[model samples]
Target chain A: MLKKLLEFLILWIIWTLLTWSLALPDILAGVVVSAIAVLLFSDLFPAEIGRLLHPRRLFWGLVYLPVFFWQVVKSNFDVAYRVFHPTMPIRPGIVKVRTSLRSEIARTFLANSITLTPGTLTVDCVDDHLYIHWINIISEDPEEETRLIVEKFEKYLRKIFD
Target chain B: MSNLVIIFLSIGLFFNFAGCLGLIRFPDIYNRLQASTKCVTLGTIFILLAVVIHFGWNSISLKAILCVVFILLTSPTAAHAIARGSHRAGFPLWEGSIMDRYREDQEGETESAN
Candidate 1:
């Protein structure tokens, strides 16, 4: 409990710094208010007692981030080409794909990862299957398209978080 | 200006650029969201640290505190809503995925329904 409270203070202070404000006494008061809010949130939301911490897999996780970065750089042009071309060669549709990451956090991350980019969006995730909408799926094969996105993310997430 | 703070700020700016780059580069909505959220969250935290140092009072300090507070509160919520919204639209997970627990549960429920 004490540790959680300390985290609350640390979190509040971080918030105070973010805005670059100068109000002293008020900010202090705000911290208490925010702390209370966090406390209430904890009370309201019962956390599942599970092995929340994943075992150390630091090397792959760290390596994976750069891999993700490269994909982001490469994909930007692919998307831009489709969007800006005088005669847009676009093949947009919804496709279903599967993933290896079963943990909710990894799955959620994978889902969010897809949505963050330009042309494709994760339409639905029921269990392990993810439905994605591509503004331009380059190949006609849904399997290939889903493989491209999932393999990149899941491989890293499995290493990083699970 | 503190050298440490300057370093953090420079790194934060780099993250900001990276996040925007992800927004531009990724092939779909979900991937872009991942890059922006992770990068911006990290960048904003660093930027906030610089601000906290620049201001030492209570009230403004409080607002800075509030900024972080609100960010923590909203970021995941916003992301969750977007993901669920997309999922309902019928997007699929990638291939080589080994599980579909949700499908099993849903199927179980529907079978029981019958």
Candidate 2:
């Protein structure tokens, strides 16, 4: 109950901040509403609430942003090149590759990372394997491509949210 | 000079630009997401930090702090949701990944149930 109250207070504080409105009455009302919300919803998903407040996981994310930023820039230019090439030297195919990670959290992070990049879309992931749709085929070397994708993103996710 | 603010903004801009570049160059979905999530988060925080400083130790600063907290809260969850949804819809991982313990467990359960 104490933890729930703390969480509620934090969230209300956050809500008040995001609104950029610091009026005392609003803050009070916000706290009240959030408290009610917690009361009504606590039994529905207690585990998720616990996970949401996981500090260790969030701390790692603080370390992750810089690395991820660098990768984004490099891919943008490459994606642009593929799109602009008039002859359309793009190869469209879905390739499947396995993952070493076990948890749904890790695997899901991997999938979203792939899709967030420009030229590739995460078409699927079954049994720890990813099905990716690629617009530009830099090479037909499936092993090399698979290695590059997961090596590029999954490694960092392990650090950030593991 | 308020150099801290300037420096922070510069770093923030650099990260945001880097994220955009990664989105362009990466070979597939996984890599691009990494770039965006990392760069944007970092860039956005720095920007928010700047806002806080600019606004001074006032209500705006308080709000800025809140923004950071909320962002710290939701961004990963959003990314996770998207990734899981994609995977469930049928995306594949790379070949070198030797073990998929999650899949193994799922299969194991189904097999035993049957």
Candidate 3:
């Protein structure tokens, strides 16, 4: 029951922010819409609502954002450099890396972060291991690969989700 | 203000162009996904950032930021799904590819299950 209310509240907040409206009709519509959404998809939502709003987790999430944005920008430049370079220096391959993040949400974020970062895309994830396609293939050792790719994101995700 | 918008727009276009070029140039599905996902996602974000700047801090700008959040969340997941699908469907890597530990792991898993 509490979960349902929390979900509805979140959806209502998103609706308010997206519409940026305080009109009576708009607010009422958001309430109705969010209630319906919560009823329909409540079971699909994550089980732990309390941890989501934890102050430490929220702080870590905020810190993660700028770090993630910087990585995205750096990777964009790297890809641009490769795409325009005459030699087209790339050694594409797939490698496996292990992650310590046990929770689904944390693993998903870790995989997405890997995909968005430099010269790497997460091809698949099974259990603790993630299969990553590397554009550059710098090292063949799995530990080295994980260190270069997963650890950077996993450290922060551990705090947020795990 | 307009100059900032133009600057962001130009940076966005450059990344988008690189993504397109990578789509054409990369030898395999996974490599192409790598290039396209990173460059294009960043490109679209920058483009939307320009929209936010152009509109300033109004509802339109907030909507643009929301779009950025959606794109950032969705694009990589979509790319991941495609890459996983292509691999499981037995799409061959490029001839110049160096390694494929994923296939090895899959084979190992099947053998152990057997």
**What order do candidates take by DockQ, descending?**
3, 2, 1
Top-DockQ candidate index: 3
**For each candidate, what's the DockQ?**
0.11, 0.12, 0.69
lDDT of 1 by residue, A14-35 (tens): 6666545658876886688778
Q: Worst ten-residue run, lDDT, model 3 chain A?
A: A44-53
lDDT of each: 0.60, 0.61, 0.89
What TM-score does each model's chain B reach against the true chain B? Answer: 0.73, 0.78, 0.92
Interface root-mean-square deviation of model 2 in angstroms is 8.8
Query: Where is the poorest 10-residue window by lDDT in model 2 chain A?
Result: A44-53
Q: Indicate whether candidate 2 or candidate 3 has the larger TM-score.
A: 3
**Stretches of candidate 2 above 4 Å error?**
A1-7, A32-60, A139-143, B1-114
- Candidate 3 segments exceeding 4 Å error: A19-40, B107-114
Instruction: State the lDDT at A90 in candidate 3.
Output: 92
Q: Better model by lDDT, 1 or 2?
A: 2
Q: Tell the DockQ for candidate 3.
A: 0.69
Model 1 Cα lDDT, one tens digit per residue, B1-114: 888778868866776676677577655555555555655655676677667766766656566667765664466447656755654465553342333333444423443456
Task: List the candidate numbers ranked by lDDT, top first.
Answer: 3, 2, 1
Q: Residue by residue across B1-114, what tens digits does model 2's lDDT show? A: 388889889877877787677677654454455456656765788889998887789888887777776665466556545644654555554443333333443523443455
Position B35, candidate 2: lDDT: 54
